[model samples]
Each structure stands twice: as C-alpha cells, then as structure tokens.
Target: MIQTSPKTFRLHIGIFGRRNAGKSSILNTITGQNVSIVSDIAGTTTDPVEKPMELLPLGPVQFIDTAGMDDEGSLGLQRLERSRQVFDRTDLALLVASSNIWTEFEAKLLEEIHNRKIPVIVVLNKTDISPPDPEIVKSLREANYTVIPVSTLSGEGICELCQAIIESAPDSFVNRPVILSDLVGPGESAVLVVPIDKEAPKGRLILPQVQSIRDLLDNECISIVTGLSNLPQILSRSGFQPKLVVTDSQAFKEVAQITPPLVPITSFSILFARFQGDLQTMALGALTIDNLKPGDRVLIAEACSHHPVEDDIGTVKIPRWLTKKIGGSPQFTFTRGHDIPDDLSGFKLVIHCGACMWNRRTMLSRIERCLRAAVPITNYGLAIAHSLGILERSLSPFPGLLNTLKTTRSV
Candidate 1:
C-alpha cells in the first residue's frame, strides 16, 4: 500500500547546479533513496527528476533534481532550458557547489534565483575533499545567503540542510488556505452542482471537485453533490438551505438560474482563481477583453492536457464567446499543460484555465511571467463571467474584487 499526496499539494523544491557538483547526491541523501541516477559522467541526468516524500515538520515536499546549468552542446542547451523551466515553478531552490569552487556560473544562478524572489540555500558539497572557500563563504554570508557545507560521503550537514529548507519555505505553504471550508462554517452545508457532460471523466470527479469535497469534509462542513438536472430539486427541497453553492464554470449560467439570489454561489474555477493565483490581477485582466481587437492574438492556457471534443471549453466554447463579444475571432493560440510560452509579447491577452492540476507556486510563476511580458492574463471563470455580462454578480462574494471591477469600468 502506498500513501502519497497529490503532486500539486506538495512544496516544490528544485535542486540546481553545474554538472558533477553532487546535486543528485544531495537529493539522494535528503530523500534517503536514489531518486536520481548519480553518475561521475557529466549531464547524466538528462531530464528533471522528481521525488515526492514527507519531510517532517515541513509536511509533503516534492524535490526536483535538474540537469547541470553548465551543460554543453545542443542537447546540453536543451537540458539547461528544461532546468530553467523547472526553476520557474520552484518554491525553494538549492544551489549546490562542490570542492570550494564558486564561479560566475554560481553567481548567475544566484542572480536568477534572487530575481525570482524565491528562497534559496547554498550547499557546499564534497567538504571532505575540500571545504568551501572561506572568502566565498564570508561574501555569501554578508549578502544574506545561508551557506551549509555537506558531504554526501559522510552524510554530514544533511540535518542542517533540512532544517534550513523548513525555515526557508514560504509562509503561505505552512499555513494553507482551506479550499471551501472558509466559505461555509462548520456544520453548515454546501451544495456542489456538477454537470455530467461529454467532457466529464468516466466514473470520477475532476481534481477541483474532489479536492473541494474533501476540503469541506476536512473543515467539518456538510456537502451535497448533484448534477445539473437535479440541482433544482435539491435546492427547492423542503427544509434544506445550503450555506453556499459551488458549480463548475461551464454550468454557471444554468446553476445561476436555478440557485436563488440569497444563496452565495460561486464556481470551482472562481475559488481556484483566488486559491492558486492572484485573484485581483485576474479580475482586472477580465476587463481587458473589451480592448481586444479582431486580429489581436489571445493565448488560452490550460494546465491539463485532454483530448478536445466538438464543444471543448478552452478551444471551442471560450473562443466562440470571445468572437461574439469582440465582434470577431481573435487569433486564438492554445497551450496545454506546463508549456507556457516564454515569449508572451506577441499576444494581446491570455485566458488561462482554473489550474486545478497546478500548485500555487506554479500558478503564481505563470502569472509572474505574464506580468513581466506586460500581457494581461485572466482565468476561465472570470473570463466566462465577463463575457456573459454577469462578472459583477459572479464576483459578489469578494466585495473588494467587485469594487475593483466597478472602478475599472468607470475608468
């Protein structure tokens, strides 16, 4: 029997360094297992390796061992690119240097890590052979970088490294937000409206729905799940009033019609818009749709790759709605899963999915990328509501966001 947490729920720690710097060895020691193929040969770990384990006190963590930044040739460049991609999603970064060597490569890595504003710990490995340079250590310390010397051969300093990681973890991870529980109090009831459509998974709910139900249960809130057809009956039944109602965004219109005005109604995507990324930025991005021209390029990003049906949401439905709103179809570019383009300059606006399959770190990373490129990015739920002319009503749960929408509209 295996007990494993969802990858998205774990803290992502990326181990990065030049080739043969014992990056994989550090991962092996920390995980107590050979999570990566450690070899004296350079560039042996061609791709990023992931290890999910429970790091005590820090809770669940996913360690990613990436290829060396100093890799050579065409293949090496690709590997380096992949490693950089991993860095974009890392919550905490471990920069491994061995045998007292700290060069421009390490400095550049430090610059990149610091630019991302990610917490980092510098590990000086192979201390048995040669300890870290005293001058280099002093300089790094003066710059406020935590330096820990460890030897994989002797298992030295591994404990300190783990402790450093726990201390360096973002405060958001240590105190996670309750998915749906915060909305409905303990003993209160929540009604989930799930539409069983062609896109629905066979015999299983999507990740967001499952997680929401589990969160309600964990928060001691009662949850009642119903399909779109049965939602009216469940809501109108005698002597039962749910504290809140959450529906899939695709069924927002029907659910809104069926749900009464007094009940607070929201969508799973809306919840995730706040949970995984910056809700305020996404809400503002929703207003950008009015500025989209017919030929303006729009990027539609989805976190999970799935086969598209005739009426797919990302490619078909959303595009259809946007065309009607903008008076013509914008150049729709679709990117599935984690392959968010590095260059967002060509796009006028980006409409992203709820990102239930992604962690908060990854979602924020994408949002940061969009911000850097000066591209407006909004999630599916907000985009849908804005196009449907009910964005203000749908965002009623968050009064601040509603005010933001009003201010932006007035401007």
Candidate 2:
C-alpha cells in the first residue's frame, strides 16, 4: 500500500532578485508576519529565508526569500550564488524588480530560469514609485512569460499578483502530484525494514520511519515494522503477502537477497525521493558511482546536525560501503546543515541525505547545482540501492522511474 503526507504536495514559490528589491517586504505583506529580515541596507538577508503559510485560493505555499542577486563584493558573490541556487526547484520564480523593469541582471536571471524550464512570474514591485516599463513587459511577453505589477507599501496589485502566481505556476502543481494516498487500495499491508544500528537515535526511529508508518495508517494500510535481520522470516510467515516492502538503504544488500523477486521491494530512500523529489532524475545520478576514481572527492551532505555516533551512516558507513562496492577509495568529505560549500567543483559525487526539514525546492536546487557543475548527485537511498545487488529489484515499485534509469544507464 502507498502512504504519503499532506505537506508533500504544496506549491513552492521562490522570490528571488537583486538586493533590497522589496523581496522581504513583499513576503511580509503576503504572510502578514516578520518572516524575512527587513532592512534598507543592501544584502541584509544573506541566507535563503523560507516561510510556509496558506495563500488564499493557492492554499499551502512556501515563500522562499533569497539573498540579493546583484550585491557586488566577495560577500555579495556568495549571496548571489545562493540566490541563483534557489532557481532549481522554484515551481514559480517571482523575479522581484522595481518599476525600472527587467534590468540586465533580471534578464540574465530570466534566461537561466527559462533554460531550466521553470515558469517565471516577473513581479514589478514598488509600482507606487513609477509606472512599470512597457519594454520590460514586452521583453518578457515576447519570451512567453507572465508579469504582475505590484506595490508592497500601498498593497496595490498584491491581490492580482497572488492570483496570477497561482495561474502562472506549473499547471500540474495545482493538484500536487496526486499524493501517495491516491495510489493504493484499502486494507493492504506494507513491511518497513528499519535497521536499528548504533547510529539509530537512542530510543526513536528516524523521522522517515515514524512518518511513513503514520502515513500508511492514514492511507488505510497495515504497516509491519521489523529490523533487517528478521525481515525475511516476518514476510515468510505473514498471513498475507505484503503489498510492499520498504527497507532502509543500509540493509539493501541483505534485504534484497531475502525478499522474493515477485514482491515489490524498495528502500525508504527511494520512497522518500518519490515523496520529496524527481525520482528519474535522481536515479540517473546514481550511475555516477560507476565512474568514480580513487582520488576523486565525494561530498556527503546532510540537512540535520546531530551528535554523530561511531557508526554514523553519513561519515563512516557510507564511505566504507562506497569503497567496498566501487573497488576504489574516493576522498570523502562531509557537510551538514543548509550551507552547501561555495565551490563544489572538487567533488565528483554528491550524496545527499533525505531532506525532511528542507522544502522540495531547496533539495532539488542542490541537485541542480551538482548537475550544473558537471558532477553526479544521488541520495542516500538511491545510492545504497544501486550499490546493493538489488537495485533493479528495489525499483520494481516505481515502474516509470525504473524504465528511466534503465534508459539513462544504457546511454
């Protein structure tokens, strides 16, 4: 049976532009909260600020306030890099600009957004200052874009802009991927293989396990929780064949061998990838492991900060696993939290954690960055499934993705 959380399907609208373009002001006016740091000085908001709130008619949407794109000094370059990073997962790109219209910077940004196939919403902020330039409107329209004129101070055109954002966002996102709850029949069973390793938090299963169980229950599925060692026996003795078996990536090898070929076996990482991102694109990245060389550096990136145990998967276990499977020892580097390194060129492979805390746009944006740098990126689950002998077996749950990966690897 399939299970999913409601929050999984929300429109991720990102507000990006030059420094002090009233991005924060627009966010504050929309959410009616002190969400972004409002300051007259340029570059006050150096990091990406995200706020999740209900937009009328649009429902639950995330407003990501990004740093200035035009700030000049070395610090500005870093901020600009981060702002550019937001474009990858932006369902709707709101290019906040003044009445001056699409400057050279905005034009360049628009080109990048369109090149990635992301929809754009040119928000002409501070309309109260002066009428918007017709040339800017014409330029965007010529490129088949949508533009909305608005002023945060006077609230003029704000309503129209919000409505336009919903209209301009990707047509399919309005329904939000038909959450997993929409997939399975009622009263089915799903077996979850959670390995309780030393790195497994002291008393609690990780967020993915807890959330998956809750989602399955909500979707009217009976979820059986067991560790890797006992999974085979449980499935063997079960009264009915499980509809699905979701295992942690760490046990992909053992779990694959134990699971019958007929059963639809997949890893929590793959499911999470489906739950959180583009499955085919991420799966293709997993093939990068085949090309890894001994001296190449691979970045192991995670979203949360924890007191890592001796057997921490990101630090020790993953490195060991990669070396064992690939037959070469790539220099492994680790990074935690939202800040990705400024320069990613050194790393040939970027293995990211399941970003439960981050919005989809952010994680997808990271994947976009890796692709731009000509590096391959994969998630923990996908990588583990690939390294294990059962990658093809695990992908049985996702037919479309399985076909895509088969095609990509063949290419």
Among these predictions, the greatest TM-score belongs to 1
| C-alpha TM-score for every candidate | 0.95, 0.82
Q: Give the lowest summed-lDDT range of ten residues in model 1.
A: 389-398
Worst 10 residues of 2 by lDDT: 175-184
TM-score, model 1 to reference: 0.95
**Each candidate's lDDT (Cα)?**
0.90, 0.79
Question: After superposition, which runs of candidate 2 have C-alpha atoms over 4 Å from their true positions?
Answer: 1-10, 39-43, 100-102, 133-143, 178-184, 202-205, 214-219, 228-233, 278-293, 326-328, 338-348, 398-411
Residue pairs in collision within model 1: none
Residue 44 lDDT in model 2?
A: 87
Off by over 4 Å in 1: none
Error of 2 at 336 (Å): 2.9
Over the stretch 1-411, how does candidate 2's per-residue lDDT look in tens digits?
844323345577888888888999999998888999898898889888978777767677777899988878888887777777667557888888887756688888778777877888888888898889888888777867788888988999888888887788676566444223333446887888998877777788877787778777877878889988788688789566887888888888788789888788887777767666667767877888888878789999997788888878789888887887888889988999867787898888899888766656667777777878888888888887777656678778778778887887788
Predicted candidate 1 versus true structure: per-residue lDDT over 41-136, tens digit per residue: 988898999899899888999999999999989999999899999976799999999858999989999999999898999999999998779999
lDDT for model 2, please.
Answer: 0.79
